[model samples]
Structures are given as C-alpha cells and as structure tokens.
Target: MEGQVVMGLQKLRVMIGSTTAIGLRALARLPHGTRLIGLAASYPVIERWLRALLCVYQPFPDIETATKYIRRFIPAGHEHSDVVSQLKQFADVTRESDYPVLFYLSGYAPGLSRVFDLGGGIGNLFYPYDRELRLPATLRWMVHDLPDKEEIVLQFAQSRHENRIGFSRRMEDASGVDLFIVSGALHYFEDELAVILARLAELPRLVVVNRTPFSRADPIVTTQVGDGYVHACKLHSLAATIAGMEAVGYRLVARWPVHERASRVPLRPDLNDTYWGLFFVLEADRRRRDASL
Candidate 1:
C-alpha cells in the first residue's frame, strides 16, 4: 500500500508539471497575453504562488529589483551564519569544472603572485587548488566578499594555518592584480565584466569567471531560492559578456561548461541554460610583449 502511494505521488507530480506547462503555453497565445502575464507577475499573491509552485519567483526586469525582493528575505546574503556554514563544506571539495581553472592557473603560477577572488566565500577554491597545484610560496590571495565574512574567513584560515589567504572588503584592491577570479558569484551583481574592470585603476592581466549562468536569450533577472536562503541573479547574455570583454582589449582563452550548476526559469523554458566557466587574458599586454620579443 505504501509503495503504491509513493508511485502515485510521483505520477501526480509529473502530471501537474505537464499540465502547468501546457496551460502556460496556451495562455501565451491569447492577445495581449504577455502583457497580462507581466502585470500579473507584479502581484505579491502571484509571486507567492509562483514561489510555492516552482521554487522560483517573478522574473524582474533587472537585478536591482530582484535583489530588493530577496533582501526582504535575506538581507546579509552569505553573511547569514547558515549560508556561511553551508558554503564552508565546499572549501576542500573540487568539482569537474575546477580543472579548467586549475589548468590555466598552473600555466600562470610561475609568474603569478597576486590573486583577487571576487565574491569568493571563505577562500573555498584556495585550499583545494593549493592542495592540487602546490601554489607559489609568496603568492598573496585576497578574497573580496561581505564585511561580515571577513571574521569567519579569518577564523577558517587561522584554523588551517593558511597564511597566504587574506580578506578584503574593497573591490578596488583588485586594481593591477596579477589575476582576478570570480567563481560562482558574477550573476549576483549588476556590472558587466568590463565595467567592473574599467573602474579599477589598472586591470588584472588574467581573469577567470567560473560557475556563472549565461543564456542565449535576452537577459533575465530571477530569484534563486535554496534551503533557508534566497538570492537574486541575472542570467547574462553569453555573446554580450564575451563582446564586452573583447571591447576592453581582452581575449577569450578558453571556455567550458559546468554541468553541476544550472538555472531554469519557471514558465520560460526558452531561458533555461547551464552554467559556464571562462578564461580571459589581456590582448594588448600580450601584443606588447610579443612586439618586444
């Protein structure tokens, strides 16, 4: 009897999902359907219903609006103790997507001295990468994240007796750094890669953007809800990101898919996409050195 009930519930779930998809598709065919849906999305009641049904909320026009919505739930982001604790588990674990970053870091290790890890939580990648690649003795890795994370990161580093890893609250500290890494955190911000780098007095010669969600469709801001936490993320345009980096004198060295992470917007199957990792280097700097050679 219990086994029958379990199978029945699974069937029911599939039935409901299929029904919802069909209904949404049909509704989209009506005149002014898209406009009506957009207006309905603004209602808090609808938002709650969507959240309950799909585990995703309304698709905001931009990240700022989505961020405002999430703030009502989680004001401090990773600063929340539970979020931090959950993130700490990945400190020493490496994923398949990490190898690409490791490959590039290996090649750059000899000449690399400084690394700015934007939005890196508790120096997660530092420990695992160090274990695998045996980082340079003099390397200085700065983790740029929330001010509240500084203490937690410090404690973790101290416990591990990791002297090379440090914390910073300023993004400008990345100016003229040897390398800048953004792993699993770029979508949360509003700025493009070029815009962020342009603000720095000097750009890092090498940059790695890993575990980021990108879509071929137009940009969409969606909320990601996990156990006890919610975050606003914008699915960036793949072409626009690469073009923006190129316009700023950078070249795409390598790109790879990250199968472990993905994003799916409710009722928008067209916007569904997987995460990716990218590596970029300054073309002008390379050209200068080649010319000198």
Candidate 2:
C-alpha cells in the first residue's frame, strides 16, 4: 500500500508540472498575459526558486557579470576536450541553416581569399563548404578560437591536406580579411557587434552572423547549462543589432530564421527568442553619408 501510494503521488506531481508549464506558455501568448507573468517572475524569492527548479538560472545585466557567476560552477565550459571532440562529429555535416550562408558565399567565391572565422571550431564549416562551393585556390581561412583548439585544428587540417585553413589567436588579424564570419558564437562576447568592428582597422566587405540568439526586448545575460558544460550567453535586441551594423557602415542584405536554435530563459517568457542568421555588406556611400550627418 505504501509503495503504491508513493508511485501515485509521483505521477500526480509530474502531471501537475506538465499542465502548469503548458498553461503558462499558453497564457504567455494572450494579450497582456506576458506582462503579468513577467511581473510575477520578478519577485526575488519566486525568481530564485523558479530558476533553480527549471535549471535555467538568473537574468544578468551583462555577459561579464554572468560569466563571474557561471565560473563558480564550471571553469571554461567550452574548452573541455570532450566538448570539442563531440563538436568535431559535425565537421562534414550541413544543416538547413547552412544553406543561406552557402547561397551568399556562392556569389563571392571567385574573389574570396581571406576569411576570418570568429569562434569557428576546427574548420567545421570549411570542410563542408569546400565540397559545395567553388572555393578559390588562394583561400586562407583563419579559425579564431581558444588556444588549445589551435593544435587540434592544425592536425585536422593536415589530415585532410587542407593548406588553406589555419588558426589565429589575435582579433587584429581579422582586419583586411575578405570575409568575416561569426556563426553561433557572437553572444559569447561582452562587446556589441559594432563595437568589435570599430576596433578593426579595415572592416571586411562581407559579414555573416549565423545561428545567433537575439531578443526583441533589451539584452540580458543568461546561463546555458548543457551536457558537461555551462556558458554565459547574452541575447541582444534584433533591432539594436541591425542598427549597430548600420552605424558601422554595413547594411543588412539578408536575414533568416534559425529554427533549430531557440532560447527560453525560464520564467521570463518576454525574453524568449529564436536564433537568427544575418548577412551584412559594407557600403562606402553609407559611410560617407553617416560621416556627413
């Protein structure tokens, strides 16, 4: 009788939790319901318990602040060998989100020589893209990532006899590149896109930021607890990102939804957002116009 009662209570709790989650999500969709939910979520004790229960953690004002908190649990979550090894499995694979990037690259392939891949992992895109696109013989694809990833990428490149792909530790090396790409890693940095670009001496004509999370609301830093890893991710406003690019003399040429990735920062339905794929091109005329203004 006691065992049966315990099992019955467990099932009841599961059912109640599922029903509540579904109800909350449905409520978030209704008029002003999201605002009401947000107000309730803002209570300090409730927020702490909700975050703990959901495993999604707190809402931070910036990436630096979030990072400090996350480091207490895990030291350099992404730099682990197991994580890099697991990511290597996708080196030759292409997803639906990759098609948009390939489409843009097809147009610029003939003259594309230098590509600075910010936070690119061990030439994941390079291997797959080379098979599909007519890549230039003089291509120098630089993967900028953690120091440990360099040797791994170098060995991987050598294994395939790919002399075109290399590794760089310096962001300054991104200057004068033919193409600048930041796929799925832009949110890891504290700086805004425009702020980073401003530091570059000569901005690349083409920029592609893919599979990055962006919010319609103001930016907030959140903790992403993955298998054996934890990362501090900042979801910036989509409009702010576009405006920042325009401010840096780049125009939005294309934008697409990365439906595979989404962020639901627990309790904060207002902060939930899907990932985005964006393409930008530098315009000298726009630069001149902005300067004149």
Candidate 3:
C-alpha cells in the first residue's frame, strides 16, 4: 500500500511538470513571451520532471544515462563533422561562383598580407581559393579552431600540400594578423565574443563577419540541432553587434544579407529567420582621439 502511494505521488508530480512545460512552450510562441517561459521553465524543474519520467520504467545505476538524456534538450559544443560539412558546402559554392567574401577580399587584398580565420573548419575558405586562383605568394593564412579539429585541418592542408595555411588552437596565434575573418561561427561564441574581442592588444586592420544571424528583436540564445548534434547558438541584435564593434574602435564599413540561407530560432521564427554579414575597419583616428580624451 505504501509503495503504491509513493508511485501515485510520483505520477502526479510528473503530470503537473509536463503540463507546465507544455504550456510554457506554447507561451514561447507569443511576442514578449520567451522571457516568461525562460523564468517559469527553470532547468531544475524540467530536469526533475525528465528524470522521474525517464527513470520510472528502467532505473540505471549510472548517472551518465540521465546526463546524456538531459543534454539532448540543452546545447553542448559540436565535433569536427558537425562544422566540416557546412564549411564544405560553402566551399563548393565558392568554387563555382563569385561570393561576397571573395568580392570583399579583392578590395582589401592589397593591404591584407596576413589573415587569421577564426573558427575556420578544414580551411574551407583557403582551400577553395588556393585551387581556383593564385593567392599572393607573400600572403599567410592561419586557421584557429577547437583542439579536436586541428588534426583534421592539418590533414586537409597536407592533402592540398598548401604550405601557407597553418592551424592552431590558440587565439594568441592571431596576434599581429592583418585581417580577422570570422565566418559562420561568431554566433556560437555569443556573449563570450565580447571578451575575446576586448582581449586583442593590437586590433586587426579589418574584421569581417559573415553568415551571422541577427534580429531587430532582443538577443536570444537557443539550442540548434544540426548534423545530429545539439549546439548553442545566439541570434544577436544588429544594432548591438554594431555598437560592440564601435566600442572597440572599429567602424562599420559594409553590411549585407546572406540571402543564401536563414536560421530560424525555433519559437520566435518571425524575428530571427534572416542572417546578415558585416565588415568593420579599425578607426585609427578615432582610437587616437579617444586616447587623447
């Protein structure tokens, strides 16, 4: 009788939690609703409910099973293939046609003798350009990515026998780089991006960010499921991103829409479906003016 009563109480708690979650999810679709949902559906409440429901049938001695199950709902970082496939797709497109990056590069190439490609996967930008056109013999390109991706990028570079391309896991490797190119990757850094941007002792002459999703609405961080993995991505505010750059003595030089693709933030589809690109140049005059102040 005692065991049955405990089981009944567990079921009741699960039912209540499930209903709350469902309603919160629905509320998330309405304007100005996400904040409310974020508050009500706190991680603990959701985790507790998931645990009770998932463990009731077959209990596991190890906690790993539960952690794995819960993480499916949350965003973890991604592995090589998750990023490689998307980069390869972009590379293939670049090979066949003139893309915006190439257009921008043409205008700046004379001045850009060195480049740091942040979050560059398997040298996607370098490989295609190297094969299609002759890069400046004096140009040096470095790719910075997660540690796990270094080996794969090295192999890809070796396959092409491209000596100009180098790989590193450290951001310090980007020091003194003439150009900083962050393509299709900044959103992953989200709030952390500001910290990284601020840490640069000597800013690059130019910074180009491409395929970044932005919105007029408030910034949001959400989980994105891609290539069978869950990753955290942020949809930033265009104004805010520009402000951030300006804060660091960079001026917005150009802006455009990707047009090729859009990213929808699940519940707020209307707000963040479109992606944008931007270019910023260091304002030496402005920096000197600020220093004088």
Candidate 4:
C-alpha cells in the first residue's frame, strides 16, 4: 500500500510538471504571453519545468561535477589564468582611475581585515589582490570550498609559503569574518543560496558577489557544458536576490556588469545574457561603524 502511494505521488508530480511545461511553451508563442505566464504561474513550478526542459535537451551526466576541467583545459599551474589576465589589464590603468571595488574596500575596511571567500576556487580572487596591492599586515584570507578543492588550495598556499591564507571545507569556519567574497559561485548553489545566507550567524560587514548571472524576467536553471563535463547553473532573479539580501540586513551599495562573458538562456532566448557584480554592506552596522570612525 505504501509503495502504491509513493508511485502515485511520483506520477502526480510528473503530470503536473509536464502540464506546466507545455503551458509555458504554448504561452511563449503568443504576443504578450511571456509576461502573462510569468504573472500567472508560480516561480518554483516554472523553475522545475525549466530544469526538466534543459535536461531533456542538454543532458549532464553529473550535476556536482568537479572543476578538474580547469586543469585539463587551462594551462597547468595557471588555474586562475582568467582572473590573472583581468588584473593585468587593470594594472595598465592609471592610479587615479576609479576602480569602485578598490575604492570601496579602502573606505570601508581600511585597516586589518579577515575575509571568508566562499566557493573561492583555489583562492583565485585573493591571489590577484595579494599580489597587486599592499594590504594590511593583519589580513587573513580564508577560502571555503569542497574538500578536494581545499586540498588543491592548500598545496598552492604551501608552495608559496603563504602564511596569511587558509582553507576550510566548512562554511561555519567563516565566523567573525569581516568580508565575505563570493565570485561566480552562487549559481551553483541556487537551491541553497537563501538557506546559506539566512544561516550565517556571524554576518560579514561586507559581501561581494561577482560574475553572477541574473534575469529580470524569472529564475532559470540550466546545464553548463564545457571541458567534457556538465554542471547545473541558475540565472536567478535580480529583484528576488536583492530581497533575499535585504531580509538578511544587507543593502546593495553598488553594482556593475561583467562584460567578459555573455550567456543566453537555452529555453528563453529573449532574456538578456549579461552577468553582473554586486557589492552589499550590512546597513545598520556599517552606518554605526562609520559614525564611530
């Protein structure tokens, strides 16, 4: 009897999913159907169907695929070649040039700081900053990633004998961190982004999100294929993302486009392909600290 009930539930889920998908595709053909469907349909239902559609068209054998592709595709010992290239370009800019990120950090975290780099991928962001800038003496950079990735970072840090850098496989180790840097990583944790944000008890004073894809229309989940591996990525809603941050006592201070990469939704070609970077600060805490300073 229990088995029968489980099978019935599964069947119902599939039926609802298929009907929702068909309705959405049908609505896409009409003149103003996209807007109408967005208003009428639930976001979760639509997102589920979008994932299903992507799987049918662009199947990924594994969702949690490793980043060993970086080694295979990118040159060895240059895992962060992309970031390094960007930094090299920035180096040509005059000292008077207004780089918002550098300016913001100078004003907000002028002194010694501790940074928790979530999904940092072998400390790519930190490597550039450490090599390029004269940071405070007491700076500590902690990178949180998968265990295998952590080992990779550890090896990299050891090779350089970097005392200021550390690695962790757990998010809880980020406690008391001053800055939380999340670059090109939120999409991979689409389902858990909200939960992870909400659970951060020791909220950082600053949060930096770079190369995150967002859509004004609706949230989309699609498979990204490259280097013979497939991984799921989500293009989330801009408004929804802002709201989630606001719920956690953070406010957007600045935002800019990441023009290096352009990506379109596989199912919905109408949406823009541009990605963006966002800087957020804990509003009340920042204001109080500023006043004190």
- Per-model TM against the reference: 0.78, 0.84, 0.69, 0.65
For candidate 1, the lDDT comes to 0.77
Candidate that would win on TM-score:
2
lDDT tens digits by residue: candidate 1, 1-293: 99778757644643454455446546655786545655665797885565445322546778877777656534445566677876788886887899999988787877788999998988888988888888888999999987887888889999999899999889989988889999999998877777788777777889999999987677778776655456888888878888888877789999998999777665554666789999999876532211110
Q: Taking the tens digit of each residue's C-alpha lDDT, what string does model 4 give over 55-124?
A: 3222222333323322222223223445334433543342221245665666655464889888777765
Highest lDDT: give the candidate number. 2
Counted clashes in each candidate structure? 0, 0, 0, 0
Error of 4 at 251 (Å): 1.8
Tell me, what's the RMSD of every candidate?
8.6, 6.3, 8.3, 10.2
lDDT of 3: 0.63
Task: List ranges where model 4 is wrong by over 4 Å.
Answer: 1-99, 192-194, 285-293
Query: Which 10 consecutive residues of model 4 have the lowest summed lDDT?
Result: 69-78
Error of 2 at 36 (Å): 4.1
How accurate locally, in lDDT, is each candidate? 0.77, 0.79, 0.63, 0.61
Q: What is the lDDT of residue 193 in candidate 4?
A: 48
Q: Quick one: how many clashes does candidate 2 have?
A: 0
**What tens digits encode model 2's per-residue C-alpha lDDT throughout 226-286?**
6556788888888888899888789899999999978776456787889999999889654
Model 2 CA lDDT for position 290: 26
Per-residue C-alpha lDDT of model 3 across residues 1-293, encoded as one tens digit per residue: 99778757655654553454355446666786876534433576764554354332112223344335425333344573656667656655563223666666666776567889898877788866655555777778888887777887777778767678788777876665778888877876656343566666566777888877776667766544443344556667778788878877788888878876666543344455567778888887542222210
